[model samples]
Target chain A: MSKFYSSVTKKIWMSFMGLFLMTFLVVHLSINLLLVFSPTTNLFNEASHFMGTNPFIQLFQWILFAGFVVHIILGLILQIENWVARPKGYRVKAISEESFFSKYMIHTGVIIFIFLAIHFVNFFLVAKGIIGEIPKTLVDGKSVDDMGALVIALFKMPYYVIGYLIALMILGFHLDHGFQSAFQSLGLNHPKYTPFVKGFGHFFAVIITVAFMSIPLIIYFIK
Target chain B: MDLKLKIWRQPSAHADGKFVDYQVHEISKDASFLEMLDILNEELVNKGEDPVAFDHDCREGICGMCSLFINGRPHGPDTAITTCQLHMRRFKDGETVTIEPWRAKPFPVIKDLMVDRSAFDEIIQAGGFVSIATGGVPDANAIPIRKQNADLAMDAAACIGCGACVAACKNASAMLFVSAKVSQFALLPQGKVEAKERVQMMVARMDELGFGNCTNTYACEAECPKEISVTNIARMNREFLVAKLS
Candidate 1:
């Protein structure tokens, strides 16, 4: 346990788990965007139903949930350890000129955590019929459960769409640092490949964020 | 060739420090920076005043004892050279040069421009060694290290334990120094036997000594007299990971 909790070892643990979370986000965005392509009530219902009832998806979701908890815990641990390592009362005269995303990761991460809580309350609880009964849906010659309806209805609320979009942008900013930094934590940075890794991180963050945010906008404004 | 010097003067560690201005007249351009300072000290002694206190042992630049932040640099304006190797030709006549000691919590001001860097020695004593039994001296080439690994270990070993890296860093981080030491030993087969415990112990000691975290600003490498690469820090991270998992 002492070996597991050592200063350098914690960085690798955080980076591996962060990369795992990044993969999970990619798959999640892909599945969420299916609603945008097929907006018909029955089409979304069938998709959501397939996702809900699949044993593989269920297992993966559990893994993702555990990953989220561990990632956050380890991230907090690493931050605390780094803080403790530094000399007390010493201040740098020079201001760090890195991007806002890179410097304020902990802050952005906290905001994203709040977004996650809202996301869980709005989607996860609703889908499981835990908080409120999901309304019925009928279209495309089929009847469906109300999880898809709840999403569409929530998006229709302008405030909810705006909130979701804001959350996604924060998520984008978090990934901008988290993705590249995790590789750095894992000692994967080399002169020939570091810039490429950083570029890919920025690009991947933008794509995930833009794709996810587009779903809400399409549901709220277009359909 | 006259040079104006603004040297920090403090009677004792508990005394308040301030700069004392002096003018060195007719200095040779070929004179080393510390030699020039020595001439200035002789002048102060002739004037019946206390000479500035600074640290230096080997004028050849290998002892790593000479430390002076000349004109806002660890070793004057030159890159990849220690203070003792710095020449007066790097400065112009009538220039006011400011000299200071290593400023970090771990390194406390002793007097004038001299700072106590025993914190580094403490960190080293924590784990910076391999427990080899002293019998007869082993054959020099018995290890048979790969060319690449030998070169890397030699490069890392080039770090002379200079506190310049700490003084040059914005955060006063000792990562480059600690990592270089760790990499130098860990790269060889003899060192690899205890590589896990070595990295773990060194990093833990580094943190325990109140040094700042490495932000990879490259300042330490830039100002390092040995030009020890930040790549050593990355290597340390990898070694720690391999040790933790396997």
Candidate 2:
């Protein structure tokens, strides 16, 4: 059999793509945190402008998009294959001892996808000059797309805040399982370190969710 | 103890199957789960009814033959034991016990609760072995295997090829079974020669047979009669990647 069609190969690629997207989350949360913690300065706007226009970051953005696309496609394929594997349903509903987050990965994943769609249209497209006009502001004495202002404005809306918070919460659930799961898929498990990885996954999930959720709520309530 | 059995009954592979409820009175609490079924079959036979067909061998845990999904659990709610090792004391009096076969596309129900597990045999035939010269018995210490590796390999070797891992999986994945087989050989020096081809071939056969890919939910580990660790799965993944890349 060709290695491309192998289940293990598909899972390995999925792991790589998942880990890549997770790194993007780290970078994203770091920059967005500036919006809440350093609102008075141009740090958030400058960081956002840098991310949007920097040649290296611009080149990496396409790779990032590919990461998202590949992850979703592979996930769907595996899930479909999983469904087909069990054509006959059991008469008695078996009680599963699996983690609640692990069982509904696809559900949480679809919600995250929806959130990403709306999120890209709201910020990414606007910044790219594809949808609405980019709001301009002076960053380091040069006018650039003021992504921070747009983010703050959107967060101020109650509905947007509510939706964003819910999506972030769902994302937390996805990451809680995905983080350690990615490691397992990559065959990186070790008895000495696996527990640590599992713990850190939970910690990472909570941190990302809380940090992202805080920005919007702070913007709406305090800022 | 008296019990109500909701057993799955199908005449043949292509026949329509349904749950047929039967009552057993004064069943000994000390009787094994299979023994309980045996008594029920005896009663049915005496009544001139079709006996519930199932699988069994040594009536012990090692053979991995007895496969009954009792009460939504493979091997009747017991951990680290097969169906034959499960005793009736695990259940309460008058409890309704549900019995079914291992549910997966690869393992089709042959009769009532017995499934044809020849798919596992086919996967094993693909490549689950190390080819060695048959000239002479090699000296035991000549190969010199590490204690740690030997222990781990033995742990992987503990798998009895039962379909419980497949049954318990939400996706009917054979990852735990295949991984255990792969690791049993992959962890040893003798197995090093054909390790690459072994994992690749077994995994391919598994996918071809329509077993699902593992999402790492670990339901297999929970329901495994032998309690095989999922670490073997990670080891198999590592072996597969190394094989593919090199």
Candidate 3:
């Protein structure tokens, strides 16, 4: 039973974790959009403060972090297994037909990982006051950390803005396949529903990407 | 019609192989792909040279014995047909066709274009069967199966165990093949008794034998001779999940 639960089974769990992270992205992207809607108010700051202080959010944070780590680690392991599956590459590999996004999953995944490291450094470290001082603002009657200020500051840097935009585009590409694929891996497939799922996957990919990209672009251009 | 052939030639599994170019002239277009190969082999034999070795049991395409990676596509450039059923008309006259074996770690080259597909047999042996008593033949109506399920099982059962799915896969993953075997049984009543152990053991053996993980590329379906759907893979996943959880 232990042997049965070891390697390939990780793929099933990774699918669940990958989808969970995708859900987290929807939430994360919505919150980031708060910056573009009203950067001047303490609404974004209040939301951030609540997220940092909320008991449930704090607990979910650990699970979310675990989801990211395991997804990444198992992805690398699967990639290695895939590589070992064919140690000798085909002499003539002319792909007549296959999805374009399906080819460079690891490439896009690596790009997303790099962007995530930089993203966490800019925002998460600042929130924790480990790298930069956290700015405080009063929202409604209570004092809160200026999360929007930190985000707007980062967007002001042209390179960070460009990098963020590119990263979101890559994220979109990753999700273009990842979304429907996770469903397939988890056995949510049917002839009737799969076309819808594929369409929904692409739609979600584009929307999330455009939404996240808008945040950085709006901040850079307006401020 | 005349055609140029660059066929992979390996004397033995341990020997280094290279492409040996040969030209055939005045071949009829209506000739089947295997028939064209037959003509080429005959010419080589007449010239006192070794004939190109390939696999074929039933030239009509049902046996799944023939496999040839022609011009970078499994079973030649045609879609949804085995190499045995492929016609030489698909190739233009004077075209150079490159033939290679099914190149995967689990499927080492036996010689020329033939690969050892026993790994597939091993996967089947792992859990692809149901134990039953014999001696007296049971009535055909003894076990009742749903029409829809019977059709799905028959669809999965259409897999001829050809390595084209693995050959066409970029990662050389046999998920389609393994899943087809698992789904064929998991769908039926007799096979459901051991469905848990079947999926678990087969998947374990698949991993142990060094097949790549399925990344939902769908190339297996695209190039499968039987045109097996990747949905069977999803079914296998569902079975695996249920087995592990329960």
> What's the C-alpha lDDT at position B217 in model 2?
94
- The i-RMS of every model, in angstroms, reads 4.5, 1.7, 2.0
TM-score of chain B of each: 0.95, 0.98, 0.97
Q: Which of candidates 2 and 3 is the stronger one according to lDDT?
A: 2
lDDT of each: 0.79, 0.90, 0.87
lDDT over C-alpha atoms for residue A111 of model 1 = 90
**Please, what are the lDDT tens digits per residue for candidate 1 over residues B74-98?**
8778988999999999999988888
lDDT of 3 by residue, A1-223 (tens): 2244544487688799989999999999878777768747477887899899999999999999999999998888888878888877667775648877988899999999998998789888889788978868888889889888777777899988887888889899999999999988998889899999999999999999998888888788875
Candidate 2, residues B71-108, lDDT tens digits: the string is: 78887788889999999999999999999899999999
- Ranking 1 against 3 by lDDT, winner: 3
For A1-223, candidate 1 gives per-residue lDDT tens digits of: 2234555565677778789989988877877777888746566677777777799988888988888888888767655544544343222232222344655667788899998998898888878778888776765656567676788888999999898899899999888888877777687868899889989999999999999999989888788
DockQ class, candidate 3: medium
lDDT of 2 by residue, A58-149 (tens): 99999999999999999999999899989997877777577669898999999999999999998888988999897688877899877877
In model 2, where do residues sit more than 4 Å from their true spots?
A1-4
Instruction: Going through the candidates in order, state the TM-score of chain A alone for each one.
Output: 0.88, 0.96, 0.94
- True-contact fraction for model 1? 0.19
Of all native A–B interface contacts, model 2 reproduces a fraction of 0.72
Per-prediction DockQ: 0.19, 0.70, 0.64
Report clash pairs, candidate 1: none
Q: Which ten contiguous residues of candidate 2 chain B have the minimum total lDDT?
A: B129-138
